[model samples]
Target: MRILAVLLMLTMLPVASAKEPYKAKPGVAGNITSVGSDTLGNLMTFWADRFKGHYPHVTFQIQASGSSTAPSALTEGTANVGPMSRELKESELNYFASTHGYEPTVLVVAIDAIALFADLHNPIEGLSLPQIDAIFSITRYCGGEQPLRFWHQLGLEGQWANKRIQLFGRNSVSGTYGLFKQKALCNGDFLPTVNEQPGSASVVQSVAYSDGALGYAGFGYKIAGVKTLPVSPGDGPYVKPSMVNIASGDYPLSRFLYLVVNKPPGQALPLLEQEFIRFILSEEGQKLVERDGFIPIPERLIRRQLNKIAGDV
Candidate 1:
C-alpha cells in the first residue's frame, strides 16, 4: 500500500505540473507596422497569417510603397519596420543614422532571382548577357524607328527579325529596378523606351500579351503565360529561373531580400516581429520560401543568420 501510494503521488504530480497554463513573455503584446518594398509585400502577408498563432494579441500592419521608402518612413517614425528587397544604399544609411541616430537593423529573409520574362508565343529560347545588355541599354535596338523587330535581329537563330521587341519594366521606385540595374546591366541606365509598370504581376501580365515583349521581375512573378529567359554570367549554359537553380547559385541574377527596422524596435512593438523573422529563417519558413518561387538561402547561412537575428530569443 505504501508503494502504491507513492506511485499514485508521482503520477498525480506529473499531471498537476502539466496543467500549468502556458504564457508568453510579459512584454509580448501590441501591434507592429511595416512599410515599403512591394516586391516583398506578399511575403509579409504570408508571415502575418501564420504569426498570429504565436502572438494572439499582436496585430501586423503592412504597406508597399517601394523599397526606397523604407528608410524615410523609419526615420520619420511613420513605420516601426521596413521590408526591402535591395541592400540599403550608403546614402540612405547615412541619412537614417543622421536623422534617427542609429542605423536600422537589417534582416535577410530570402533570395529572389530576378526573372526575365517574355511572351509565351515568342520562339527565342536564350539570350547572352551581352545581347541582353544591348537590348536594354541601346534605344536603337528596341526604341528608335528601325528597332530590331524580329527574333533573328536580336541574334536568335530563327530569321524572325521584324517581331518588334516590346520592353516592360518596373517603375523607378521598385527594388526590382535596383536589382536589375545592379545585376543585369551593372548599373547601366535604363533606355528611355522601356515601359514601366507598377508591380510584378502587372509586368508579368503585360509581357504575356505581347509577342516580343520582355520584362524583368522577382521570381515570385513567374507564371505560365510568360516564359522566363535563361540568364548566365558567361561561366556556363544559360540558367533557367527556378528555386533549385537560384538556391544552388546557378542563376546569376538572384539576390537577397531583407527586412529593415528603424531601430531595434522599441518595447512597444509587437513580439510577432521577432517571431515572424524567426519563422522565416526556420527550416519550415525556408520551405515556404521555395514554395513561394524564391530560393532559400542555404541552411548553414540561415543558421548563421538565425544566430545573429533570433539566437537569443
Candidate 2:
C-alpha cells in the first residue's frame, strides 16, 4: 500500500480514469530489456521510470534503434519487450513464430499520428496525400504529374515563392519511414533528394532549421520551431491530427503503438513484463500517452489489450 500511495502522490498525470489503477504485484524484480522504435524511445523511458516507482529493484535496458530491430531481438531472447510504432511485418511475424513455435503477443498501448511538419516560418496551410507524394516521391505514384520542388509550386507568394522546399525524413529502417512511404507516397520510392535523419526528433530539428523545409515524423515531437500541417486524404477539407479526428479516421495517417512480447501459447508472461503491461493499460499509463502529445486508447480498447496478457498476470 505504501508503494501505491507513493505512486498516487507522484502521478501529476491527468485523469482519464476509465480503467482501474494497477495494483503492483509482489516479486516483480528483474532487469527488463527493451529494443526497437525510435519513435517510442521516450515513451518507453517514461514508462520504465514510472514502473520503477513501484518496484525500486526493477531496472530497464532500452535500445531505441528502429522498429525493424524489434523482431530479431525478441526472437533471440535478448529483450523482454519490443516497442514498435507499427505492426510486425509478415516476415518478422513468421520468423518469430517459426523459431518460438508460437505467435508473439501484441499489446496496443496508445494511438499516434504520423504528422507532416514544416518550419514555423512557413505559411503553407495543408496538403493532400497525392500532393505529398508529388513532393517527396520521384515516381509521383499518387497520380501527381511532376515533382513539386519550390515553395512557389505549393502556392506561397513573395519571398516564399523563390525558396526551395527541402525534404527531410526518417531513414529506411524506421517504421515511420515505411508507413509514410505506404500512405503518403502511395508505396512509391522516396526521391533521392530526401535528407533522411536518424530519428524523429532529428527530422524535426532538420525542419526547424530550414525555412522552406517539410518533414514527417510522429506528432509527439511537436516543438516551438516546427508546426504540424493538417493533412487531407485526397481532394479537399484537410483534417488536423486532433484526438477527435484521429479516432474518427478523418486523419488518415494514424496508427496504434504496439508492444510485442514473445509469449508461448498456454504459457505465462513473465511477471515483470506482465505487470508493466498492466500498468500501461491502467489509468496512469494512458495518461502518459496524452502527456506525451499522443492520443490515449479508449477504456474498451484497454480491456481488450488486458485480456491478451490477462490469465498470466
Candidate closest to the true structure, highest lDDT: 2
Relative to the unseen true structure, what is the Cα RMSD of model 2? 7.0
Candidate 2 residue-wise lDDT, 120-213, digit = tens? 8788999999899999998888898778999899899998999988999999888899889988988899989999999999999999988789
For model 1, the local distance difference test gives 0.71
Q: What is the TM-score of each candidate against the true structure?
A: 0.81, 0.92
Residue 192's lDDT in candidate 2: 92
The prediction achieving the highest TM-score against the true structure is: 2
- lDDT for 312 in candidate 1 is 29
Q: Give the per-residue lDDT digits (tens) of candidate 1, residues 140-218.
A: 3322333344566766565446666788888888888987876666667778888999888888998988767898888
Q: Count clashes in each candidate, considering only residues at least 3 apart in sequence or on different chains.
A: 8, 0
Q: Where's the lowest-lDDT run of ten residues in candidate 1?
A: 12-21
After TM-score superposition, what is the CA distance of residue 278 in candidate 1 from its true location, in Å? 1.7
What ranges in model 2 sit over 4 Å off?
1-18, 311-313
Q: What is the C-alpha lDDT of each candidate?
A: 0.71, 0.85
